[model samples]
Target chain A: MLAASGKLDRRELCRALLADRGDLLVVAGLGAPAWDITAVGDRAENFPLWGGMGGAAMIGLGLALAQPARRVLVITGDGEMLMGLGALATIAVQRPANLSIVVQDNEHYGETGMQETHTRHGVDLAGMAKAAGFPRTMLVTRPEEVPALRAAIHAGEGPLFAVAKVDPSTLPLVLPPREGAYLQARLREAVLGPAAHHQL
Target chain B: MDRQVMESRPAAADWPDGLYELLKTHRIRQVAVVPDAGHARLIRRCLADNGMRVVSLTTEEEGIALLQGAWLGGDKGVLLMQSSGVGNCVNMLSLAITHRTPMPMIVTMRGDFGEFNPAQVPMGSATQAVLEAMGALVRRADRPEDVVPTADATIRLAFNTFRPTATLIGQRVIGAKTFGKD
Candidate 1:
């Protein structure tokens, strides 16, 4: 019903973010909100795992520090975030302005059978991010709030953090059994765009 | 013990000295570290410097995933950890094998050179076999002089070949007392 209502704006929010820049996109762990964006767009790359939620964000930190001019987006899950909470302190110290971490909070490891997560207990991810030294953190529970979220993200150079509270909509489960080749191939094209494949 | 004598304390490798230059020359800007005694100096060098970033992980397997992200995100990076930690990294190594992500890491090996702790021997013996099984190339360093050249060559091999390479620095080189103090 929420998907039909167009009320959840997560798909569009992710679409806008993916389309906005030629930066790095790291899809770590599972239960990400950008699953649809990753499905449709020719850009964005994801890691395969039911664990390691904050893993993408840490990788994004590395990428951002490695190349400060390029933007980096991390699509993380609430459950995965719990596993690597310490990485947040590491991010705070690095403080890369080109990095933006988006936590798609659905309150569960949705892909791994809708297991309970910290978000289920009204855990404030934004507050957590701010406390971790991501000064520009925002929380949006509705889809319409995404535009402002996007604006804030682009305008605010970070080490910034944003949490988009999304409703659980049944999305395709991707990991082993289904090859990530398709996603990698499309994202490769999106980044290189007919150029020769070169190691970075 | 004289004040002037202590103050002079004959110079060492200048803290972050050749490390940043080495990483920059190789264009290695990201690092994944699983802490160990042998490579702690190099690992701490990466962490203390502002020029490069280190991603610390609970297990070494996560370093492979981090490397995948680093490669995809447009940064050439390396994993820094100890030899025994390789046992924890098998599944992630399989993922690297399947994905063909070229990762370069300096594994500070313990338990083989002198053999104090029996616990370190099993994984130390298993490290090379595990790496080979995962299709990763392994190299060892036994002296400080070998450190720079081996690192340079391994980094080159990893980037040029687009496959993982291990630089195993034995305790004989990084020193035994470096891990613990009395």
Candidate 2:
């Protein structure tokens, strides 16, 4: 399926972004981004979506807004990001200092038969994000740039947006949990403590 | 109903203020809106209140996903949109329903009684059906007095039971819009 894979390995990129994660909240888009994050480690702070296709960025926005002090990062594929392109404008307007979005741009939909997405046709997601008013926007194609990307996610003053051109080759699926209720409960309890369910 | 009576009188509307009180009581920290005139009063009240974070969404579906994140981060929230915006939320609602996310949506009706626009008829009339099909429990609040109580029940079903619930306020309660100058 990939016409040609990008230079960066997605798993390696995720590992770098999540390494030594300290109270960092992550929202992964459905498909590759979700698997990539899970591939790193299936921790509770990682809210890997199994189905919500176009909502990864907005989820990060809500989490960032709700917990203003905590860092929020969203990892999503290009197709996922394209479908919700308006979210970039939305996130830009909100300009949450704690939120950062990393789009693993493979230029193809890695799942669903590896179809070529808009990015393959020369569409620039990073440019669009920059135009949408993201304070910091980066397009990463080299291995060396990942450290800066990781550092930005951990300590950058955002709302920041980054697009990393990752390898389009399909990888093993590392799903966190299929049941939505279970994942939701785990994340809530992990972030809010054991009494999360009893709060209402 | 007489033509002059329908044209002349501004309806007594307390539901917006009443709804605001209930949201505060629920401690809804995040309030998302895809602005609509029907929700103007409630949005105004929410904006004035210092306790909540009112987010202006580009689309109704954003609110759906936003509420999920809010709940995941230990905060309660709601979405306010118009009947037409319900169509935009169908796909996103799947994640909300499966997650059993407590989403209390307050949707003001558009295409039903006294509707002026042809564009709104399709989605507005089908709003209830669409939500129910998506696994969101739908309730209507037609009368002025019934709006608050219905909203309360919808909120309860959402948070206490972790079901996606919608309180669809009718055009009558929201007041009808017309093309001609009043």
Candidate 3:
């Protein structure tokens, strides 16, 4: 059953998704903790953020279509999504069964300077996701409501979107020069098993 | 290099037909492009044509990234750009080689081939060597007549072989000046 969470948002949603099997998550654009999961945890993180925004969504869509059996989640930001709005239509038309797009709408580019964006420009993200042919969607703005959203995500179907409206200023202070070794050990154990360590 | 082959080749007005042939015959549905005047006639035409989805990009490297993604997504794609932008894409080309993305492109020559601008020369001179260094198959289309078949052949070979192929078009092939006026 589809559900919503009030206290939690997409960052945690990404962590949860990463913890689970059956999905390959691509952290596109920037400002989120996806690399922390993939890089630190030693998962496959393609399409590194070099320059520009909005390219990753298209990348994620492409991966999903290519690997249809494997579930794919693209974690995109509001500003990045707005930069390549047409990609949404392309995603909608292709409608890959394994694709799930989760946009953390902080209403700004949190990584850069938290500048205002199209969402703040009064663009409706949920509406846009729907128009982009995502039959199942959710918009969560409150805290204490993320767990149920996690459940909805785990149980959801093709081309779903969970738009988590967030306050970027309140986010936890992330420690960087990241915990690559520790996270990789933990994640490798989780996904590939303890014996698989020697191979990588 | 065949003059008869060059003369018999169709013109820009025939691009839609050419593109249609490219899409249908080659079955290339995904295209990654960096904007440039050298190939603007074909690129603009392709963008408007519904035959394939044009993935417009901010940088030439991003074009390679998109092509990589498209390949991962099960679509054969091409990167279109002018010669100068080749330098911007070199690093990404490494990513392609490391991952074996089998990236292919249609590069229009701007600096060389009797280039007037000083800025266009460096990359134009470097184009073939740079591509060769990346382990890519570089084919130069020095004449208008060679473009269509060369593009067609490049697209086919790149996809089939899982290798990157580039077509460098001389100014004469794609028109030295823009459409409408001098």
User: Which has the greatest lDDT?
Assistant: 2
Residue pairs clashing in model 3 are A5-A145, A5-A146, A6-A142, A6-A143, A6-A144, A6-A145, A7-A143, A7-A144, A7-A145, B111-B120
lDDT of 3 by residue, B24-130 (tens): 56656667767787666667666776767776655676677567566655556778888878887775575455444556688878767555667777888898899
Docking class of 3: incorrect
1 or 2, greater by lDDT: 2
What is candidate 1's lDDT per residue for B1-182, written digit by digit as tens? 88865553432233224544678788777778888765566777777777666777766766776686666555678888888888877755654555556788788777767766778889988888888788888887676556666777778888787678887877776555423532
Best by DockQ: 2
Stretches of candidate 2 exceeding 4 Å from the true structure: A1-6, B1-12
User: Better model by TM-score, 1 or 3?
Assistant: 1
User: Against the true structure, candidate 3 has what lDDT?
Assistant: 0.63
Q: What is candidate 2's lDDT per residue for B1-182, written digit by digit as tens?
A: 99866653343356788899999988989999999998898999999998988889888888888888888888899999999999999999988778889998999999988888889899998999999999999999898778888999999999988889999999988777887833
Order of quality (lDDT): 2, 1, 3
Full ranking by TM-score: 2, 1, 3
| TM-score (chain A only) for the predictions, listed in order | 0.76, 0.95, 0.70
lDDT, candidate 2, A2-34, per-residue tens: 124548888888888898989999999999898
| lDDT score for candidate 2 against the true structure | 0.88
RMSD of each: 6.4, 3.9, 8.0
Write model 3 residue lDDT over A18-99, tens digit each, in one string: 5554455453454564443343344443233433355556666655654566566666778877766766766676676667
DockQ for all models, in order?
A: 0.27, 0.67, 0.19
